[model samples]
Target: MEKSLLKQRLLELKYNNFQDLDVDELLPLMNAMLKYIGDTDPDLRDTLIYSSFSSLILEGRYSNENLRKLLVTSVSNDYLFYGIGRRQDDSVFKRSFSTLIIALILHVNIQKNFLSLVDMEEVADRLINYLEKEVDVRGLVDEKGWAHSIAHVADAMDELVNQKLLLESYRKKVMQTIINKMCYDDDYYLFEENERMVVPVISILRQGTNQFLLIEGIRQIAEDLREKYSSDEKSCLIYRYNFKQFLQSLYFHLEAIDLCEDIRREVKKALKVINQPYYAIT
Candidate 1:
């Protein structure tokens, strides 16, 4: 393509509102440009592809399938969206980073009309079902796949509850799922050196109301699951991390707690402990 033409095409992208564009015309143009990015020199390829993906995402022309394809293609092209492994960020940072990103992405997706609460539940179900299918003959665990899918489900549930779709019945169902996973968490150390697998169980514990009764009920479930799942003494960091995660989502449990200012203020304290420096949960 002529340099002048390429420049013009890039300029057009800034103004390319897919809602106004003819999809038939735009998709082909996008495809051609994407192909061109592959031929570009390596140094400049990242800039081009990133620009292109940003444009496509902003264009409102892409759906979940397109985003999935984009992720696969981008990674195949050598994008590392990798994070620290379990041994690395022994702090709660990585888990929160993963779960929090999932939550933000879901928020963005819903705003972009690519997904809904119901759609998210289906995604969660599909992810778990996929992991279940990948298990071995004895129905033993696949730790890696389980962790990945469980994080996905937890984020989806967080979004569902945030959106008010996670009613009492659905909440019960989610708790049961985690409860089932307890046997595995107990059987395997899961992570080396006493790092408890905290996200899923913490998530279940967070489903309670703000009221003392509900909070107590949820705490009991958590204690039971902890006993059922964890063999070692509960890791304090893991406990704090789990506590903070629940605190991060504490608003869901607020209906019951609304009656007490003292309890409500305590939620803020919990958020302080759990929230990232840059952003508080509230």
Candidate 2:
């Protein structure tokens, strides 16, 4: 299937709200879409491939077996970890978009109960590893589209953390990984990345993560920001700014939720301290 032909077909499918399609016939089309998942063309990659995948998964168009395959492929090295170590490159589109697919699969699994505990744990582990290794923090490329690696993975983590089958240890690791990414030193997230990241934290809280673990995560963010504050380097300064925004976003999210008053208080205290000038001498 040529790219142009695929685009036209996907456009038609989208126009009809992805209904009445023969699942057997659409299999090849799905493969083609995955083939171009890394395409730099926003219309094809974002509008066509990604949107089509989301509609298909959310609409329950694919069989459980097919969804399982997608879940496997999305987390594999070819997609999730493709060109992973390289920074500020087009390769990010593949990795970032793959996370979206993984997130969608997990979202569907929440209701369908197709995935097993092992499947959930594997995804949880891979996502945390991806976050620790992912260096590209680009959100929206000027011409290509959104590379939002952190935010996309955060969405996947949000879904994963919501799964009751996932172990508490994995959940704790997810919480810690999210906090580490919030203090990412590469670049300041300007694309509401902080807010997107907040969703997983809230999910973790709602899913019954330990209050002590949550409080420790909050303190870790504060301590990381403090260390950055002590540095005069430009990168550290940017990290501080990003960390501040993340803390503020986190505080706002905490306020909206009814759970965890103690954790919310810790975040509030962290926010107050982060907001104060560095040179306060009384």
Give candidates' CA RMSD values in order. 12.2, 1.7
- True lDDT of residue 9, candidate 2: 90
How does model 1 fare in lDDT?
0.40
- Most accurate candidate by lDDT: 2
Query: Model 2: residues >4 Å from true position, as ranges?
Result: 227-230, 278-282
The number of clashing residue pairs in model 2 is 0
Off by over 4 Å in 1: 1-59, 63-121, 127-168, 174-217, 221-237, 248-282
Return the top candidate by TM-score.
2
